[model samples]
Target: MDAEQSIADEPEVTEKRGLFGRNKLATSEPKPAKTLGPLKMIWAELAKYPGKVALAFIALVITAAATLAIPAGFKLIIDNGFAAGGNPDDIGRWFRYLLMIVGVLAVGTALRFYFVSWLGERVVADIRLKVQDNLLRLAPGFYEENSPSEISSRMTADTSLIEQVVGTTVSVALRNILMGIGGTIFLFWLAPGLTVGLVIAIPLIILPIMYFSRRVRNISRSSQDRVADVGSMVSETLGAMKVVQAFNQESREKTRFEGAVEAIFDTAKKRILLRALMTSIIILFIFGSITLIMWRGALGVSTGEISGGTIFAFVVTGGLVAGAFGALTEVYGDLLRGAGAASRLNELLKAKPSIAPPERPQTLPLPPRGSLSFRNVTFRYPTRLETAALKDFNLEVEPGETVAIVGPSGGGKSTIFQLVERFYDPQAGTIRIDGVPLASADPAEIRKRIALVPQDGVLFSSNARDNLRYGNWDASDEDIWEAARAANAESFLRDLPDGLDTYLGESGTRLSGGQQQRIAIARALLRDSPILLLDEATSALDAESEQLVQQALDNLMQNRTTLVIAHRLATVRSADRIVVLEKGQIVEQGTHRELAAANGLYSRLAALQFTSSDAA
Candidate 1:
C-alpha cells in the first residue's frame, strides 16, 4: 500500500503479540501552587498547630529569660568580687550566681532547640498534606497549566523554606527583641550616663539593617526560583529519558542540566555572601560600641570616681547590650526573607479552583436506556478562547446505536469527549443524557454511567492487575481476567512470567502500543457502562493487533450506546451512521453508503484512502 493507505489499513483477524513497543504516556502538567502572601498566610498556617505553637512560645520566653540573666550575673560578679575592696563572702556569692545562670541557660537552650526542630518537621508534613489534598480537588485543567516539577517544588522546597522561617526565625526574632529591649533598660539603670552614648549607636545599626534586609528579601526569592528551575529541569529530563536517549541527545541534555545547576549555585552564592556580610557588619558595630563605652568606664576607675568593680560591671553590661543588638539585626533580616517567601506560598493556598461543583447539585433521574442528546452545545477551551472548539453542535445517539465521528485534526472531536466527561462545561447550550441536562446533574453521578478509552491508552506505574482494577477498584481477579478476555488481552497476559501480577513499569513502558491499547480496552470493559466513548482507540496499533482489538471492541459495544471518533475508514464504514464534522460543526451525517453515494466529505475521504490503496 502507499503511505497514506498503509497508515489507514486494518485487518479483520486476531493475532498473538509481544511486548516492548509503546511510547511512554504523556505525563500531566503540574498545577500552579497558590502565590504566597507577605506574612499573614504564614501566621495563618502556624495557627493550625496551636498546641505545638504554644510550646514554641513558652520555649522562646524561657530562652529570653535565661539570656537576660547572663548579663545580670556578669554585672554582679564584677561589681561584687573586684570592686568595693573585694570581700571573700561576696566573691563566693557571685560565683554561685554565675553557676545558676549557666544551668538555667543550658536547660532553656536545649528545650528551645527541641521544640523548634519538632515544629519544623511537623509544619512541613502538614503543609505537604494540605497541598496534596488541594491538588486532588483541582480540575484536570490545573495540571495542563503547570509542570510536575513545579508542583513538586511547591510541596517540597517552598514549604521547607517557610518551615525554616516559622520554626526558627519567629522564635529567634521574639527572643532578640526581648533581649534588645531588656539590655537597653538595664544599661540605662546600671550606668545612666553611659547609656546615652549607647543609644546614639541605634541610627548606625538601623542603616545597615534596612539596606541588608531589603537585599536579603529579594535575593532569597531569586534563590528559591533558581532552585525550582533546577528541580523542574531534572524531573522533566528523567521522566522522558527514553525519548532523550533515542534521539541521542544525552550530551545536549547534560549541558542543559549543567546550566541549570550553575544558575542555582550562582544565585545561592550571592544570597549566602549577603547574609554573611550583613552578620559581619552587625557584629563589628556591636563590639565597636562596647569598646568605646569601656574606654570611658576605664578612665572613671583610674580616678576612683567609679570603683574597680563598678567599672568592670558597667563594661560587662555594655557588651551584653551590643550582643543583643547584633542578634536582633540578624533575626530581623531572617524575618524579612521569610516574609517574602511566605507571601508567595500564600498566593497558592488562597486560590479558588475555576471549576467548582455547585453547593447544592441537582439530582438527575437515570434513563431506562442511555440516550445522549447534544442540543446546540457550544464550547471554548480555557487556553484558546478566540476560536470556538465547538459551535452550536447538535447530535442525538439512541441506546444500542453506534455512531462514528469522522473529521480532520482539531475539528472538535476531542472537545465532544471532554464535554461528555464533564471536564469542562459548555459555554452555551445544554447536553443531556436521557433528557436530564448534564449541568443539572450531580457531575460525579453522571460520569458513573459512562466509560471512555482515550487515544493514548495511558497507564499508571503499577502492576497489570492493579491497572485493570483502577476501572473498578473492588474488582476481583476473576473479574479482571474476564475484562482482559473481552479486550483480547488475556492470552498475552497469561503468558507473562507472573501473569496478572506482572509489574508494568512507568506508564506501561514495558508493553507495546497495541498491548497498552488492549489494557485500556480491558479497563473500559471492566467499567461496563451503559454509554461507551472511544477516541481513536485502535489508531496506533499494527494491522494485526487492530483487527484483534476491533473484534474485542465489537463484543464490548454490543447493546451499548457507543460514540467512536474514528481515524480508519474501515471502522467508520461499519458504523450505524457517520457524523462528518468540519470546523466544529456537524456539516453532514448519514450511513457510510448513503454519504458515499452523495459524494460529500465522507465520499472525498473514502476516495483518498481507496484510490491510494488501489494504486498500491
Candidate 2:
C-alpha cells in the first residue's frame, strides 16, 4: 500500500497523518511551548500594515473624542441655559451645540468603519498567501510527519482570530483609550472635588481588568486549541467515510466525534463565563462610583455652595467619565482574545521548513541525461527503529540504463526511489548525479529532472487536460494527447463526453483503478524527464490493460534512465539488470535467466509467478 492508503487503513486518529498527514503529538513529551505575551510579536506582524493601522487609529480617536464631547454639550446646556436667571438666548446656543456634536460623531463613525474593514481584509489575504508560499517551499519529508488537517485548521481557523485585531479590536481599543482620557479631563474641568473622589476607584477598576485580561487571553488560546482538535477529527472522519461504512463503525465514530465536540463546548463555556464576569465586575464598579458622586453633588446643592444647574452639570460630566471607562474595560477584553489568536497564527508564520534550497546553488540542465549513483547509502524512517530502510546500499545507473529493484515488502525496494528523488537525505553516505551532490543541488532544480509514478497513481479533482498538463505546465494540446496515447489512455479518454475536458470527480473516482493508473503514467510521460521511477506501475492493472499499458511504458522507458520497484516477477523479467534485495542488502544481481538458474531468492520469487508465458 502507498503511504496515504496505509494511513487510511488504520483507526481515524491513527490514520489522521496520511490523508491529512501530520506528525503525531505524544503526551510523553512536553506540550508545545507557549510564547510569552502580551506578545510584541503581534505588533511586529501588524507593523507590516502601518499605513492602514495608523489611519484606523486616528479615526478611532476622533470617534471617541466626538462621543466624549456630547456629554460636555449636555453639561453646558444644563449649567448655562437651565440655570436660574440665565438669558433666554442660551437655548438657541445649546441647540447649535447639539447639532455640531451629532455631525462630528457621524463623520468619525463612518471613517472608523471604512478604514478598519479595509485593513482587516488586506492583512488576512496577505497572511494566507504567505502561508501557501511556505507550504510550497516545504520538502515532502516535512509533510510525511505532519498532518494536512492540522496545517489546514491552523491556516483557516487560527488566522480568523487576527481579523478582529486588524479590523475591529484595533479601532475599538483606540476609541476607548481616547474616550477614557477625554472623559477624565472633562470630569476634572467640571468638578475637581468629585474627580478626587473617583480617582481612587480608577485604580481599583484598572488593576482587576489588567489581571483578568491576561487570564482571558490564556483561556481563549486554550479554547481555540480545542477547536483545532475537533477540526482534525472531523477532517479525518470525512476522508475515510468508505472504511467507516465497510466496517459498520458509523455509530462508534459518531460517538467519538460527539465526545470531541463536548470537550470543545466545555472549554468554550468557560471562556464565555469568564468574559461575562469581567464585564459585570466593570459595570458594577462604574455604577458604584457614579452613585457616590451623585450623593455628594446633591449635598453640595442643598448647602447653596453650588447652584442646582451646577449640580446637574457635575452629574452629567461624572456619568460620562464612568460610562467611557466602563466601555473601555469591555473592549479591552476583546483585545485580549484577539491577541491570543494572533499568537497562534504568528507561531505558524514563524515556523521554518526543515528543507530549504541552497542560497547559491547551480541550476540543473534541461533534459538531464546524467549518471545517477548511490555510494554506501543508509536511511532510517522517522518512526521506525528496528532497522534502516536502506543500509549500506550502493548502485550506479548510467544515463539511459533501465534497472529494476525486486524484493519482498521490507527489503528496501521503495527506499531506492525515495533517495533518488531526494525526499530524504541518506544518513551514512552520498547520492550524486553527474558528480554533483544532491544535498548541494536546489530541490526544485533537482526534482525538475526526475519523474515518479507512485504505486497508487494519486489523482486530483480536476479535468483530464489540466491534470495531464500538470506534468508540464508549458505542454501544448498535441503534447498532452500524444502523452495520453503513449500511456494507453487515449482510447478511454476519447470515449468520455468531453474527452480531456471531462471533470474527474474528486480524485478521479469516476474512473476505474486501471484507468486512473494510466492517466498517472500519461502525466509522467508528459514530464519527459531524464530519470523515471516507477513503483509497481502495472501492479494494480488486470491482464488485458497491463499488456496494452506495458507496450506504452516500454516506449516511454526506451531512452530514459529508469528505476523500477516491483514485487511482480513478470514485470522485471526483461530488465537489463535486476537487483534482488533482502533486509536492506542486495543479495543478488544479474539478468533474469542468470538469476533464475542460480536457484537463490530470485529463483524462488520467479518460481512463484514468472512462467514463460507470463513473462511474454
Candidate 3:
C-alpha cells in the first residue's frame, strides 16, 4: 500500500498489559485501607435509590437475627424439655417458637434477595450508561490508542462482574458477618471450654483460606481478560468478514477463535482448582476442630461440668460461626473481582477527549458561504507520527468556485478533506472556513456548511427514507423527492418494491454498486450544504449512470464551492481549475486545455485515461 508510507506512524506506543487481567492483586496480599475508596464509586450508585437499599438492609438484619435466634430454641428443647419430667407442654411450646423463627427467616431472606438483586441490576445499568456516554464523546485519537472491541468488552464483561459483586456478594458477606459475630457470642455463653478450643483453631483455618483466595483472585482476573480477547477477535473478524471470505480464510478464523476459547478455559481451570483447594482446606479444618470440641463437651456433660442442653447449643452455634467464616472467604474474593471491574469502568469515565470544544468558542456566522482555506499546514496522523501525511500544504477555494485535485496515490488528496473537517488538527499552520480559524470555531458548526460523498458511499442499515433523511434531519417529503430527482436516483428508487421505505440492509448491500452510489449522491444533494466534496463519487457507476450522475453533479455544483477528487480525467476536464499534485506538492494547475498544452503531469494522466480506446 503506497498509503502506508504516508499513513504509518512510528509503531504506536505499546503498553504491555493484561486484558481482564488488569489491576493485579493476590488474595492474601494485605489490601490497602484505601482499597475501599474505589468501592465508594459503587456506593454512590447504590445511594441513588436509598429506599430500596434501606429496605434490603433492614431485611438482611431481620434474616440474620432470626437465624441466630434458632440456636436458643435448641437450648430450651435439650435443657428444660429433656429434664426428668420431660413435659409435653414445654416441648410443644418450644417447637412452636422454633417454627415461628424459621418462618421469619424465610420471609426476610426472600425480601433481601429481591432488593439487592434489583440494586445489582440498576447500578450496573447506571454505570454502563455513564461509560457509554463518555465513550461517545471522546476524540478519534482516543480510539487510535484503544481498540473498539476492548472498549465494548469493558462495557459488558466488566460491568457484569460488578453486577455480581453488588447484587449477590456484598449482601451475602454482610449477612454472614452478622451471623458469625452473633453465633460466636452464644458459643462462649453455652460452653466456655469448647469456645476456647474453637477460637484457637480459627487462625489456623484462616491462614490457608487467605492464601488460596489471593491465588483465585489473580486467576479470575486473568480468565476474564482471555474471554475479552475472544470478544475482540470476534468483533475484528466479523467486521471484516467480506475480506476473510474473499480470501477463503474461513478455517483460519475458526482456528483463531477456538484458540481464544481454549485460552479462557485454561485460565478458568487454574482458578477452579485453587478455589476447590481453598474450600477443601477450610471445610476440613472447620469440621475437624468442631469434632474434637464436641468430644470434650461430651466428657464435660457426663461429668456434670456442662448441661446436655447447653452442650448441644454450643455445638450448633459453633457450626454456624464456622460456616459464615467459610463463606466470608468466597465473598472477599468476589469483592476483589468487583473492584477490578469498577476500576476499569472508572478509567473510561475519567478519559477526556483530546479534541474538545473551546470553553468560549466563537460562533460561526449563520447562512454560511463556504470558503475553505488551508495555509502552510503540516500534519501527521497520531498513529504515524513519524511520517507526515501532508506537509506545508496550501490551498484556498473561494465561495461558489469549483476546483478539481488530481494526483497519484499518496499525494494527500484525501488528507485535505480530513484536515478541512478537523477530524485531526495539523501539527502546524491553520485551517479557516469563511475567514474564521476552525480552532476558534466549533467543529460541528464548521462541518454544517460542508457536505461529503466519500469513495465508499457509506449508509446505515435502515429504510431508504431514513438513510436519505440523514442528510438533513428536518427535510420534508417534498424536499427529499426533489433531491432524489436531482441526483438522477428518483427513477430506480421509485421502481423498488417499497420505494422510499425500502430497507437498504447493512452498508446498502441490497442495492447495486451504482444504485448505492446514486443514493449516496441523493443524500449529499439533500444536505444542500454551501460546500461540496466528491471523492471518486461516481467511480462505482456504469457509463450511462455516470453520465446522469455527472449531469446531476453539474447542477449540484451551481453557485456552490466544490472540491472534486477523481481518477477519471473526463470528470474534471470542465472544472474551473485543475490542480495536479505529486508527493504532497502541487505540480500544476489550470483549465484542462491549459494543462494539456503544458505536456506535464496532467497531460500524461490524460494520455493514460482520456485517450484510451474504450474511454467514455
Best by lDDT: 3
Ten contiguous residues minimizing lDDT sum, candidate 3: 1-10
RMSD of each: 11.9, 7.9, 8.6
Model 1's TM-score against the true structure: 0.76
Model 1's number of clashes is 16
Query: What tens-digit string does per-residue lDDT give for candidate 2 at 1-616?
Result: 1212221222122223422333444221112224336336556656887887787787787777777777667667877777635677886788698889889889978988998888777777777877778787766776666666667756775556566666776676666667668777876776788778877777777666666665665666566566778888889989999999999999999999898889878977876777778778867876777678778888887886665655565666556565566556655545665555555556556667665677888666554775799899888876565679888988888998888899778899988877777777888899987767888888777778888887877889999998888889899989999999989999999999998999999999988888888888899999988888889988878888787767777877878888898766655876889999998989999888888789899888776767755543
| Per-residue accuracy of model 3 over 100-131 as CA lDDT, tens digit each | 99999999999999999999999999999999
TM values, all candidates: 0.76, 0.78, 0.79
Question: Whole-model Cα lDDT per candidate?
Answer: 0.75, 0.74, 0.80
**How many backbone clashes are present in model 2?**
9
Best TM-score among the predictions, by candidate number: 3
Model 1, position 519, has a per-residue lDDT of: 90
Per-residue lDDT of 586 in model 1: 95
How far residue 413's Cα lies from its native spot in candidate 3, in Å, is 2.1
Rank candidates, TM-score, best first. Answer: 3, 2, 1
Candidate 3, residue 428: Cα displacement in angstroms equals 1.7
How many steric clashes between backbone atoms does each model show?
16, 9, 3
Candidate 3 clash pair list: 9-384, 20-225, 27-214
